[model samples]
Target: MYREVPSARVRGAVLWWSTSPSWTTPVRILPDGCMDLIWSQRHGLLVAGPDTTAQVGTASPGERYVGLRFPPGTGPAVFGLPAYELRDRRVPLTALWSEGRTRELDERAAYADRPERLLESVAAARLGEAGGPDPVARPLVARLDAGGEVARAAADLGLGPRQLHRRSLALFGYGPKTLARILRMQRALSLLRTGVPAADAAARTGYADQPHLSREIRALTGLPPRTLLTTTP
Candidate 1:
């Protein structure tokens, strides 16, 4: 079972998902250009970084997990480290923060029924120390989702290509082109979840055709578009 809850406390957190899969197989996590603050019953707290390709993972049978999925550009700010540094990796909170802090958080998470809320507090504290979120995050994602090309995106935002790439790597764990693709994938997934035909979803979401959409989806998910539609959420 997997379900998501709205985040009332953290800005740019798309949602918090709780999962307890049957553990008959490893789950293939898709590329969504997002980072998650994850808590595992067996592994404690960790950061799941932005992924460029599908990642396979599994839980021990009967174990549960709670994760706060933060949209692109939020992770760097929340963790006080460049997002690129953690790309395609999952690291324990202790590796990023002091042992004392991770221990405290692990204890709280072990007790709370909705432990993901405790992570919101952790994000809040980090944001406070950093002053606030980067001003470019929302607009950057908006432009890319609107189908702007990377070079054009930088020019429109009055940023040079190198500067834009640097900031994107720091905040999103990749360059603008990859960010744009991932955001588009997210849009395609949303449309598929709503029962839209793949060809129509592709056309509406900026792909050239159904095959184009299928290839991209397969590359990021290791599964074809139809396979993904069955578990759209």
Candidate 2:
């Protein structure tokens, strides 16, 4: 079983999920242009960075996991590192933070009923410590999420294409074009979950056609729409 709680405590901290499986299940996590702080009985506390491709893992039977997923470009703010540095990687939290700090966090998670809330609180505290995330990243990401092309988005932000690309690569673990594709795929999937036909969802979300949607989804997730939907929330 898995469940999530949407939170309002921090900007870009979308939601948290807890997972408990009765069997060792095959897990396929698609790239969502976001990052997650995860705690598991097996891995302790760790960071799941932005993935350019689907990540394959397994859920150990009888073990539990909790995760807090931050919106695209925000995880780096909370972690105090560039997202590019952690792209396509999962590393122990202690590698990024102090050993003592992560050890305490691991200990706390071992005892907490819902470790995600603790992770949320820690992220919130980090926001306060840094006086908040970069003011520009939010709007920049928003424009991209709305399907704006990279060149146009850069112009709108008063940035040159090269300038925008540099900042985007540093902040998002990829350039604007990749972020746009990821967000668009996510939007298309959300529409599909609402019972919109794939063709309509594709058109509504800016895909050239249904086949275009299928190709993009498969490219990013390594699964067709139906199978991917079963795996995602």
Candidate 3:
């Protein structure tokens, strides 16, 4: 089965797998700035982003996998906007395959060969260094990080609530409120992982109560806070 490890840096999550059973259709997860390295017996190696959700069907039986996930601020420095957008749609790495740089990834997956080598090679290509924050996204991320109320944040940005909603959708594929919620939830998860009590984590992360935190965490991660933090990656 698939297994993962939390990154030591705490800015990201990492996962490693030895073997796993076949999975069904793709599962959709929310957008975030993380990358993955997937290896399989039938498909050798693939590196992907965390902004998109992916179907697990392509993985073959008896394969080994390792994934490195980059946190939000760290993301723009790695994969460019195209890769980020591609990952946002859960598209496969091979779909965007190129000749010189990314070809080795496709070839390795097809041949079921040593994936780590390909992982190192492709990572060295430095695709993440291309883009900067979307102009519209910057203020929103800043406001959210500063613990500003959603309505106030929008107002301070000189955007009406509805205008901010539209801009967030155009820029991040989600509304501002939804993006704010995700950012809050991510902060809560980080706090909880670092030994903060559930109640305290909720308050510090701007949740009204423990149940509020639980509900949001469940909505974003498909699991409750305790399960999410305690469960091995």
Candidate 4:
């Protein structure tokens, strides 16, 4: 089971929890341009970084996990590392924060009656200390989500292309072009999930054609669009 709630303290964050069922199948985690700070019953505290492609996750049966999902460009403030450094990786919280701090968090997480609340408090505090995420994060994402071109987005953000690319690497773990493609794929998937035809979804989401959509989906998710719709939960 999985569920999420909007964070009351942190902007654009989602507090989520998941439980593994009796079966021991690997779960495919889709790339959603977000990072997560997780506390697991079987593991300890972990940071799940932005993913360029789908990642397979496994848990012991009945395992439970609590997580704070940070929207794109927001993780650096809370985690104190560039997004690119953590991309496609999952590391112990100690790897980023001081051992003492991580230990304290672990202890509190272990004992807290509402661990999700603990995650929210910790993230809110750290983010405040770091002065919050980059200012460009939201507008950039919004521009791209609206099908804006990279050059136009950079111009609108008052940044040169190279400047935008550098900031994007730090904030989103990739260049603006790559981020646009990912965002487009996400849009296509959303339409597909609503039962839109593949061709229509592709056309609406900026793919050249349905075959192009198929190829992009296969590359990012390692599955055909049809398989993804049926397999993803």
Predicted structure with the largest lDDT when compared to the true one: 4
* TM-score winner between candidates 3 and 4: 4
Q: Who is ahead in lDDT, 3 or 4?
A: 4
lDDT of 3 by residue, 1-233 (tens): 65556654323335455554454323334445344555544444454544422223333444455555543433333444433354444344554445444556556545645444454444434533344434555667778766788899888888898887776654544565666776787788788888989999999988899999998877777667776666523
Q: What's model 4's lDDT at 158?
A: 98
Could you give candidate 4's per-residue lDDT for residues 1-233 as a string of tens digits? Answer: 99999999899999999999998978999888889999998777999999999999777899999999998889988898899999999999999989998899899899989999999998999888988899999999999988999999999999998999999999988888888888899999999999999999999988999999999999999999999999886
> In model 4, what are the clashing residue pairs, if there are any?
none
Model 1 spans with C-alpha error above 4 angstroms = none
Question: Model 3 clash tally?
Answer: 7
Q: Write the per-residue lDDT of candidate 2 for residues 1-233, one digit (tens) a residue.
A: 67766767877576656565787878887788888888888889989999998898877787777888887777888999989999999999999999998999999998998777788899999878987776668888888888888888888889998888888877789988998999899899999998999999999999999999999999998999998887777
| Candidate 2 off by > 4 Å | none
Q: Which stretches of candidate 4 lie over 4 Å from their true place?
A: none
Q: List the residue pairs that clash in candidate 1.
A: none
Among the numbered candidates, top TM-score falls to 4
